[model samples]
Target: MAFFKSRDEKKSEEIYKIIMDTLKNRGNQVYDLKVEFQEGVVTLSGVCDSEATRKKAILCAELAEGVKKVNSDPLLLSEAAAQEQAAAVPPAAPVSPNPPIQTAPPAAPSVQTAPAAPVSESPLETGFPSAEAEAAELKPSPEPQPSPQAPETAARSAQPSEPVQPQAEMQTYTIKSGDTLSKIAKQFYGQANKYMVIFEANRDVIKDPDRIYPGQTIRIPPLP
Candidate 1:
């Protein structure tokens, strides 16, 4: 059983290599391509230049020996390809020009009557003093009361605060050929599945985990 398992593994590796070479040589334009083969099934994943290119990659995998099935569902189109497809769609027919708007003629200027002159009332007629005389009768406002003084308490000396420790500088790694986040995580943290540590740390640089390129610098955060 062990010998047969070894043979199967070897065959899978060979098929994987063949599919990768075919994609590159045929110019299928599949970026970040990953091929997995198991139990006579080959799965292709990556960003393709177009639907046609994605189909071509699947075909290449199907043509490889020992590949009973090709799964390309995980493949996706590049942003440029998606935009090209959107552009290809015919735009909605231009809306018919709107009819000229009809506006009412400007109204004639309204005539405003002049306000009637205010009638003056003498003190003898209304038996009330004039506003000026009333204002002079008002007494001066009382002076503001002095604010109460707060009781004093004994003063305490200010204690010196501890100096803040500097944060640990995050480590950085330059991507190399065949360097995947999972591999880098394993190298630094001893766990392949902790790739998210690197991904979350370098969100400014990495948009996709599988889309890293050679010579790109990424931050490696310290393990929590």
Candidate 2:
């Protein structure tokens, strides 16, 4: 019997193969796993042994080219973990057959308190002054004023700062045949790895660091 598949199904199969290959290469086992793709959405479902394997499978699918979104079904723990979890749960306590007897509430006793006797105030001594009079007698001295030197410091700070000199004007280099970014960087900055500086400066002109053509002028930024 001949079986026909649509273009979308073929694409989905290809994507699934790539994702499975990538996961296998990572040393993660995907048993009974199924991957499906539709309109850039990728879904992964099936049984796996460990949570790590399940998550790694999903991540691998997500990283696959053209994968817009990744959806995964809830992963079930392996049989060993399920058994361990089952063993961890305590069994329910046995229920009593006979109903508990109800008890009557106890009555609260009345409490009696004796009346308090009136208090008499003692007259203040004539020799000692009242609290207000004592507070008025003791006045705090004023705090020392800020030093006049602050004004001189302020004046110095107010003075215009020295103008900063601009970094050496950006230099340019016309790319020649057989010239690489590393070669150009070594020629200008004495460090081949510093080619990134030139690439960053001339992103508008140079799109790829590995590829530069002749007659393309690129900016060479000043060294740190």
> In model 1, how large is the Cα lDDT of residue 96?
98
Model 1 over residues 104-153: C-alpha lDDT tens digits? 99999999999999998865667788898888888577799978544442
Per-candidate TM-scores read 0.34, 0.33
lDDT of 2 by residue, 1-224 (tens): 99999766776787668757876787766667777778888877776666667777777777777889888864455786557667888999998799878888787776777878878888767988889988888978689997766877899988987543323668888999999999988887666888898899988988889999999988878866
Where is the poorest 10-residue window by lDDT in model 1?
150-159
- Candidate lDDT scores, in order, read 0.81, 0.77
Residue 136 Cα positional deviation in candidate 1, in Å, after optimal superposition: 99
Overall local distance difference test of candidate 1: 0.81
The TM-score that candidate 1 achieves is: 0.34
Task: Give me the displacement of residue 128 in model 2, in angstroms.
Answer: 51
Q: List the residue pairs that clash in candidate 2.
A: none
